[model samples]
Target chain A: MNPANGGWLIALTLVAAMLLGVVHLPETWPGWLGWLRPNWLILVLFFWVIEVPHRVGLIAMWITGLFVDVLYADPVGLNGLILASVSYLGWRFFERLRMYSVLQQCGILFLLVLGAEVLSVMVLGLGSERPWSWHVLVSALVTMLVWPLMFLLLLRLRTGLRVE
Target chain B: MSALLITLESSTRLLDPLRSFIGSLVSPIYVVAESPYLLTNAVGDVLATREQLQQKNRDLERRVLELSQISQQYVALKAENDRLRELLGSQGRLPYEVLIAELVGVIPDPTTFQIIIDKGADAGLSVGQAVLDAEGLFGQVVEVNRFTSRVLLLTDRDHAVPVRINRNGVRSIAGGTGDMGSLVLENVAISADIVEGDRVETSGLGGRFPPGYPVGIVASVVVEPTSAFAEVLVRPSALLDRSRHVLVIFTPQPQIESNDANTDGVVDLDQGEAAPATNGVENAQAGAT
Candidate 1:
């Protein structure tokens, strides 16, 4: 497996995640249901950071976060900062995180997603009039629920595609 | 952390070019993502029965005729109104240049009320421009990139509109309650003449939102003798949560000469005259009843 092929695979996966993040739901869907959509980008970033710690670095995560910031119309560098921290944590504990059971990993992922959400709300809420609500927690939960599936799927892609 | 905070606080001008550049780059991702929904809708339209298509066409034709007749009368009234305004030495409201935009994406977080529209600076959209749908005032552009703009909806807790009751023209401030369907009218004295079901319209006082667009309707009025102000809940007229198409209002920059006078007049009329006049009328009506 060559580095070039693996890099392209990673890039393609990230692009797919970005598209998922921006996809619009049907107009008829209730607003409350929107909260259930997981943070697709974060899940993918976490997966890559854990599987290929040497390949996926903090700079890459931060740049992807900037793209997410632009996509979300949030203050530039907000997501970058959040993702930088999350990727740093993942990089630091990749060995242990890899050895943990899927359920334990899910617990940690839940905390990571929740922490990101709280930080985002605190930062973005400073200038805006948005009130902090419990509904944001639903997304963290949804992200946690989606983690195992994302992990397994990415694992297969890496192995099957002979991605180094 | 401090560096991040500083970046967040700075005027986005430092990052505007970069943001816009990347925004244009990723705009197609949004378009492609939205294709499935659009395709389904197109398919649905195509699969509709011939009878259903005929019925819709006939209904639309009848509506067009009815609207044209009303528009014919409105043109005459508009001329008279312009003449009266000139006679009174007051500036007429500027005609707005409106551009239609489609909702490409919505912020999924329920706590935030913002939407990304398909039009941006390329389409002459600028921050703080008022947005509306077919029903009424929707929101305002808070950020404009190259190919997209972000709108903070009327129900965002941080958004407020200067509005007046259509019935009595009593001015008040309507603030978002973080609820999609409602706005709260603030600072109205319990004794004020506002009643349930009164229509709220933009007062055009803030210079941000143009005057006279429908905002909401009073859903409930709760007056507690213990409280200084009445709690007036208003239901937004626009489908803030549903509408896919919105109009960005390009109100020409108002000239200073008449704007200052107009502001002073609004302050006087709203504070000194309109309140007392409405109070008097309400009292007289109460006596008659």
Candidate 2:
């Protein structure tokens, strides 16, 4: 398999998962299993941004954010801006992150997820005069806590998609 | 390398056809991705069956208590009406049409605090439609899509619902302060008759929402000396987070207004339009369909 074909496969899988994450309608509130949400999209994109920075750059994040914006009908460009910023940050630290073990990478990814949540709340809550709640912080914590599983999934995909 | 080059030449030529075929095959993946609950629903059913029974028991107890309170309210309302009638003339009752819809999901973000409902354009729902539950005003429809609509919950930070204290008729705008069950009364005078347990209802100042729907009950009142205003925290009347269904009222005002505009044009064309005749025709059409 050509390297270019492998990249396309990864891109296709990411977009498909992201879009599915957007359209999914939970029939009932499984508050117990609420932890199982596909926080995978951000982590996958993060992995690509770190490993293949040029291929999945700021533009890819922006488009994913816009897709989520349309799917959720949130204030337009809010999520896109946050995603692009995260991608940029991920690209900048790609070399540094490349040196770390999976467990260490998971710790840093937790912080990145927290930063993303804060950026989302700050952007959306600004000027709207809505009272800020601890829920945003809670969500950020939840996102970070899921880092190990998210990282493992991305690791599996990377190995599976590797071409000889 | 030579064999690969030959294969690439053939595949490059077929790329357009192959891409479209691949796109078609992958389209269903997104749809399947959207229903993550389908994977968990069967297991959830077995687990949730006992919990559902317990929830029903709790609901029954709540209903009994609500019934007793409602009876008390009716008696109090009748007494107030009699007193008001002696002071000022009675105004006729307002007519409204109610559409019932089920709550589908809570919006993922807390900033917007919107709920997506299953009803949409197909249900004759228009933007800015007022939504209410049996107890009180819940929120309004802000965005409408094909099969679903987004409702900006009153508890959302950006939204402001005009409300008045039922005790002294002190009016103030209530804004969401990032809580699922709370809102703050902005710019109310320090002397306002707002107290804990006071009922707050829509003032109907703006034609945005109909009058007299219960908004919430005052939870706490805090007055700071430095500030010229008082802080009133309210717990909304409807159990919004717990509510599974809501009523979207569709009053007949728009249709009436459009017909009146058409009547004016008809009268100008004909020397005298049959006023009583048009009334019967309009009434019959409204009744028939």
Instruction: Highest TM-score: give the candidate number.
Output: 1
Q: When superposed on Cα atoms, how far off is each prediction in RMSD?
A: 7.5, 12.7
Which ranges of candidate 2 are over 4 A from the true structure? A2-40, A52-60, A85-96, A103-118, A125-127, A131-145, A161-164, B1-94, B223-227, B254-289
DockQ for every model comes to: 0.41, 0.17
What lDDT score is found at residue B108 in candidate 1?
Answer: 56
> What TM-score does candidate 1 get on C-alpha atoms?
0.88
Candidate 1: pairs in clash: none
TM-score of every model versus the real structure = 0.88, 0.65
Residue-wise C-alpha lDDT for candidate 1, range B19-134, written one tens digit per residue: 77877777777777878876877899999999999999999999999999999998999899999999999987667889999987776556768888899888988767789999
What is the lDDT for B146 in model 1?
85
For residues B35-118, what per-residue lDDT tens digits would candidate 2 score against the true structure?
454446547766777779799889999999999999899778867777787678765434578899876656544345667677
